[model samples]
Target: MPAKRWNELSPRTRKLVVVGATVDAVLRIAALVDLARRPAAEVRGSKRRWVLAVTLLNSVGVVPIAYFLRGRRPQPA
Candidate 1:
C-alpha cells in the first residue's frame, strides 16, 4: 500500500493534523513527567505497563489520558 504524502492532505486536514500532533505531544510529556514522579507501587496498573502504555500508545493520546484519568495517587503514611 502506498502512503499518502503530506501535500496530498487538504488545508483543513493539515491544520487538524498539526493541532492533533500538538495535543498528543503535550499530553505525552505530561504523562511521562507524572509517571516519573510517582513511586513504582503507587501507579494503579503495574508501573512498567503504565509506562509502556503511555509511551507506546501515541494515537489520539488515549494511554496518556488514561494515566491522568485512571492512575491512582499514592497515600501518605
Candidate 2:
C-alpha cells in the first residue's frame, strides 16, 4: 500500500511550494503573451528584448522557491 502522508511538513516548506508554483505559472503565461503579441520581425526591437528579458528573469528566479518547496517535510516525533 502507498503511504498516505510522507510525514508532516513545516510551514515554511508549504509556503515555498505554493509561491514557486504561482510565480512559475505567472512567468510562463507572461512569456506566452509576449511571444504572441510580438511577431518575429518585431523581436529585434528594444521593447521586445526588454519583455523577453523580464520573462526569462522571472522564470529563472522561481527555481530557488521550487527547491525550498521540494524540501522534505519534517515529521513529528
Best candidate according to lDDT? 1
The sequence of per-residue lDDT tens digits that candidate 2 reaches over residues 7-56 is 45567777877797787777556555655665554443354554555456
TM-scores, each model vs. reference = 0.81, 0.46
lDDT (C-alpha, whole model) for all candidates: 0.83, 0.52
* lDDT score, candidate 2: 0.52
- Candidate 1 — worst ten consecutive residues by lDDT sum? 67-76
| Winning candidate number (TM-score) | 1
Question: In candidate 2, how many clashes are counted?
Answer: 0
How many clashes in candidate 1?
0
